[model samples]
Target: MTETLRARLARVGQSYAPHEHRPLAGYVAAMGAFGALAASLAAAAKVTGKPAPERPSLGDVALLSIATHKLSRLIAKDSVTSPLRAPFTRYTEPAGAAELNEEVRDHHSSLKHGIGELITCPFCLAVWVATGLTGGLVLAPRLTRLAATALTATAVSDFLQMAYDISKHAAEGD
Candidate 1:
């Protein structure tokens, strides 16, 4: 996991600026793909009476929740790099969650997030997709619901984190 993140950051160096120009056309194209994917799920759900195969399955609800955790870290990227992250970041080595957040922060800052995280949007989409997919699967009738609940809990945690960010940013704003 650590190696992969570093590799991405290192590899994307020049092209990943916050305001760099990538074609607006490219952005629209990506969103169109995303919308298509989203619509397909709904379409499928209507026919299947099952949850969309979202992004997970009955056997891997836990796995999907793990992705939700990663998404939260991304949202928290700024603080993860802050001095406060030092205490634990040192012990975590390579880069712990805080640093992970830092990387996410760096990503948003470095790249033109446009509407914000077109890349991140896919990830955020995945968590729900996984949940919806798992929900309708045959083996565990309850699994998808559990994943949805877990994802919701994770979202609350993420919200608190964002709220924290808002507070910090607000103070900085002042």
Candidate 2:
């Protein structure tokens, strides 16, 4: 009798018990990919004769940080992105519970699980988004600033909308 691949993988996963290492391994892989991407971008910039800035401006950093934050949240939680995430994650609603709806990874494979984790976590995705936005700033400053401005404006609008909702509720209570 020969041990099947699935069986072998199951045994290995069982050996790792609680499976903490899986996520760490995924993170390591993601970091390596990000490093490679950054390197490639740097090489491309050099080839194009685009010199790297000595230091990014404070405004650029601020705009990018805010945009990254907004983009991450939108990707991780916005209903508009649910279609994109649906393949990797499942939505869960608790019965009679006041807790917010949640999305959890379907965990069919290590790669899928890792991608699901990255997509669902704003903090994890922020690093990648910020890197791309920063690279854009170097490669196409005007377009990057334009997109960042739109994202920043949307973020502000979201805050104002929430505040108005809260104030309306308070006024109703009063």
Which candidate's lDDT is highest? 2
**TM-scores of all predicted structures:** 0.35, 0.81
In model 2, state the lDDT of residue 101. Answer: 38
The TM-score leader among the candidates is 2
Which stretches in model 1 have alpha-carbon errors above 4 Å? 1-20, 50-116, 120-141, 152-174
Report lDDT per candidate: 0.48, 0.76
Give the range where candidate 1 is weakest over 10 consecutive residues by summed lDDT: 102-111
Give the clash total for candidate 1. Answer: 14
lDDT accuracy of residue 169 in candidate 2: 95
Per-residue error at 40 for model 1, in Å?
1.0
Q: Worst lDDT window (10 residues) for model 2?
A: 94-103
**Residue 116 of model 2: what lDDT?**
79
